[model samples]
Target: MASQAMKITLERIALFQFTPTHCAQARAMLGWSVEELSREAGVSVEAIERFEAKREVLDVTRLTLAYRFEAEGLVFFPGFAPGRGMNVKGSTPNPMARADFAMVE
Candidate 1:
């Protein structure tokens, strides 16, 4: 049977783009295997493999992975930010929390 496509949600969207490096690093720090991550994130192991291999996957897959990591206290930062990377929670304050988003006129 053909598998169902992943669904997109607001949680999948974040201020920073989640990369394969982040996924690997977060998994390492959490001491989680791909299967463990799949169980936690409710994502497929194949999807996690594709993502960690730096292969293109669905947007929802990437987002879901990021969301799962973030929920586990992993912070993801984009490149170009000085001294920024996946960090454990409480190392630095969250710079772009959703509540911080405000419409500017």
Candidate 2:
């Protein structure tokens, strides 16, 4: 039962998708550069650049990048709504955390 529950949780998490815009916004919000993100995500700088430019990346690469950003306190929202967006995970003084924004492209 526990294993099944874990599988279900993982499946739900796998459904979340982040766009190129989201990645850029989150990086900007955290004041991180592409090189920084690449190092943290364990992906090549070229991969990050390509993903940002094309908004498409391998599923595993996307997951790695997303998790890396999330680990840095950026929370990604995966829906098409005004309130669906990224923000810092906690109540920080960062202005971006207080903004309700989304990137659709």
Candidate 3:
């Protein structure tokens, strides 16, 4: 059952992928600045800025951001409908202690 769910989640991720809006929203929810996210994700600030500005950026860069944020307890949903967005699982991220998020769609 869990594997099935993971498969569906992977499909959804592949279909819709990640967006700049999602990145900005997740970063805002986590109270992280571009510089903070750059340091955390090991992505350059210019790349982060370009991505957030909806400009062209490398797929690996975006994937790196998504993966890093996911590790920090953020779950991303890809769609325009209600409930199709990001949410922090378990609890909000804390600098002192990390939260856990499940990869299920």
Candidate 4:
């Protein structure tokens, strides 16, 4: 079951496209440098810079980068409708956290 799920994920990732802006945004949200992302994504810093500059990268490289970013809590939303973009999971305040804060106050 896990292998099947991973296969489906890989298939989806193969078809997904990421823009330079999305990469930049995700990096900024994580406060990660190009070198840092390169290390995590197992790609070269030069490749990351070129992708950001040209808004183009090989599908495998792009998927690698995306998966790396996602592993670090970044969620990528497909541009199927409005408000399509990346966001950091748990970056927003949760109700439980808010309640804890209220108790503290």
State every prediction's TM-score relative to the real structure.
Answer: 0.61, 0.61, 0.62, 0.59
lDDT of each candidate versus the true structure? 0.61, 0.59, 0.64, 0.60
Better of 1 and 3 by TM-score: 3
What's the CA RMSD of model 2 in angstroms? 9.8
Q: Give candidate 3's error at residue 45 in angstroms.
A: 0.5
lDDT of 4 by residue, 41-89 (tens): 6677877897779755565566566656655655655662112235553
Q: Write the per-residue lDDT of candidate 3 for residues 19-101, one digit (tens) a residue.
A: 78888987887889999998877778998899989998765576667766666766666663112235543222332231222
Kindly provide the TM-score of model 3 when superposed on the true structure, using C-alpha atoms.
0.62
Ten-residue stretch with the least lDDT total in model 1: 96-105
Q: Write the residue-wise lDDT of candidate 1 on 1-105 in tens digits.
A: 122222223334342557787788788888899999877776789888988898877765666667667666666666622222455543213322423122100
In candidate 1, position 19 carries an lDDT of 79
Candidate 2: tens digits of C-alpha lDDT, residues 1-105: 999798557635743656677777878877789988766556778878888897566655665666566556666566632122355442222322322211211
Residue 39, candidate 1: Cα error in Å is 0.4
Best model per TM-score = 3
Error of 2 at 26 (Å): 0.9
Candidate 1 — which residues are off by over 4 angstroms?
Answer: 1-16, 80-105
Clashing pairs in 4: none
Q: Alpha carbon lDDT of residue 52, candidate 2? A: 80
lDDT at residue 17 of model 2 (Cα atoms): 54
